[model samples]
Target: MRLRVEFTTEPFDLDEAPAHAVVAREVIQSADLDAVDVGPFGNTAEGHADAVLAAVDALLRDSLGAGATRISLQVNVVAEGHK
Candidate 1:
């Protein structure tokens, strides 16, 4: 199965990206995933279940350790023929 993960690490920083946000982006960008989209307000990645899950695990751990006060996330199963 394939999975899509969408997330944001916060205490938003308008002047610069926070450490937690930077960590979160690093986790996703380096994971064994595809279709990654990292943005100021949110981020998203798509890949096989294992890859997505592993990325999620690291994203949570690293981002929180870097001091994110909150994380908003969602995961969904991609339909068979969908992106």
Candidate 2:
């Protein structure tokens, strides 16, 4: 299932930001799932559902670790036949 997910984590160390994105991309890729598109908007990622979810997990594990605080993650999945 494809979806569009927007999520953000607590402000991270400046140097670790790209690490976050990289980990996210890596997670999605590792999932061996479909990749329609992906990009960064502030701290959020906008793209495929499976990949985005994978990215979220990666970001949490890599950036925030187990102590990560909850922020806000919004997802707007384009309905089938709409995209």
Candidate 3:
């Protein structure tokens, strides 16, 4: 099954890339996920269920460790072509 994780870090400028955001991207990419999209408010990563979960966990840990005050995460693990 595939999963998607979206997250937003707070206490940092939403307009520019903060350290936490950078860490999130690096961690997600390092996990070798299928895809990761970064938007103005948050970022989204989609891939295998296990990878997504692990990446999300790493994202949270690293982001907070990188100085993120708070994080809003949304995780979806519905297989493709589902209603």
| TM-scores for the candidates | 0.96, 0.46, 0.84
Give Cα distance to truth, residue 35, candidate 3, Å: 2.4
- lDDT per residue, candidate 1, 1-83, as tens digits? 99999999999998999999999999999999999999999999999999999999999999999999999999999976666
Q: Is candidate 1 or candidate 3 better by TM-score?
A: 1
Worst 10 residues of 1 by lDDT: 74-83
lDDT of 2 by residue, 1-83 (tens): 55665555554556554555555445545553443344454333345576667666665676555343553566667665544
Candidate lDDT scores, in order, read 0.96, 0.53, 0.82
Which 10 consecutive positions of candidate 3 have the poorest summed lDDT? 74-83
lDDT of 2 at 25: 46
Q: Tell me, what's the RMSD of every candidate?
A: 0.8, 4.3, 2.3
The residue-by-residue lDDT of candidate 3 on 20-83, one tens digit each, is 8788878977886777788768788888888888888888899999998999988888678542
- Residue-level error in angstroms, candidate 2, position 33: 8.4
